[model samples]
Target: MQKSLHITPDKCTGCLQCEMACSYENYQVFNTSLSRIKVFDFHHTGKKVPYTCTQCDEAWCLHACPVEAITMDKTNGVKVVSEDTCVGCKVCTIACPFGTVNYVQETGKVQKCDLCGGDPACATACPTGAITFIDSNWTGLDKMKQWAEKLSNQAHA
Candidate 1:
């Protein structure tokens, strides 16, 4: 049963708990700037969307790495970067369309979400249930259920 991070942007309160948790889990710090998962704030629309590596099947980062540093975790399909193998060329960063993969000056290596080795700290720390670890096959089911509930309510009214 492969699982993935399921984000509900509408439910995100912009509290940045996810960012803190991510940084703490990976870096032993509570800095948002060091966090792998970034929460994008759309102030005008009051929408806070947390974005990170989606662990694409055909990951550009993995393909762009010259040192063969990036590899897919077969267990959960997460793209993981090998710090020892990474040359810090930043080709993977440029190739990543979402800008999720990032370089760390301290380590001279790129980092991204590896789903916290199968139990995502961001999802665990989300206060509003905005970030969920769920079955990858049913990622869209929550949205479908939400729309169905709205339709049923409208019909009743």
Candidate 2:
């Protein structure tokens, strides 16, 4: 089954453990800038939202890559960028609607979330359970449940 990380922004505490873990796993460093996952801090709303590649079914990155560096891993449904195959082209970065795919000058290649080879370090490091590895088919389950609860409350009222 395909796996995905569900991030509940409301539960996030802005500790940045997820960013640190992602960077450490991929680069062996604690630099948030190097991390594929980024946490956006909304100071006005006092909120933090951890954002990363959504692993789109029809990934623009995969198609935009001229050298075929980006390909979909059928097993996990992740769009993985092969550094060796990449020609340092920034086409994929521009194709991504969410801007999750980014260019790395140090490596002269692009990077995005690879689901950590099916074991996401960011999800494991999240202290508040804001990030959870779950079945991709059920990604909308939480939102469905939340709406169901709200409907029930309205019925009672």
Candidate 3:
């Protein structure tokens, strides 16, 4: 019954509503820079991709935190930071391979997606169907990998 944010790059319009919603929900501000989610614009492809923490099983950030500040919610599979315990060492930032972990100068702490306590503002604010909270199995990544691998095999054969 665990759900996660699924993003479709082609459906995004670069409107940044997700960013605004996320910042406002967590920080009471509308600044995109303060948002946990980010919309990246690709000029060549004319695509806007919204990216955030995947909350992967490994959770490098949680393991990398020297102060043991990052913890995973077993029920929802979201990795969260404990601001009180975080020492602002920036080690977790470097450990995150996806570069989603960011340091906040104002708070002197690193921040990333927490799924907004199981109701993500980013998914709710997406004007298009680009971002959705769906059953984790329906993310389509496995399906895409299966088809892509077939294409790769056919090309090689």
Per-model lDDT:
0.94, 0.93, 0.93
Question: Model 2, which residues run further than 4 Å from truth?
Answer: 139-146
Give the residue spans of candidate 1 off by over 4 A. 139-157
Q: Which candidate number maximizes lDDT?
A: 1
lDDT of 1: 0.94
Q: Write the per-residue lDDT of candidate 1 for residues 23-61, one digit (tens) a residue.
A: 999989999999999999897988899999999887999
User: Compared with the true structure, what per-residue lDDT tens digits does model 3 show for residues 37-98?
Assistant: 99998889888899999988899999999899999888888899999999899999999999
TM-scores of all predicted structures: 0.91, 0.93, 0.88
RMSD of 1: 2.0
Candidate 3 lDDT (Cα, 0 to 1): 0.93
Model 2, 81-141: lDDT tens digits are 9998998889999999999999999989999999999999999999999999998888477
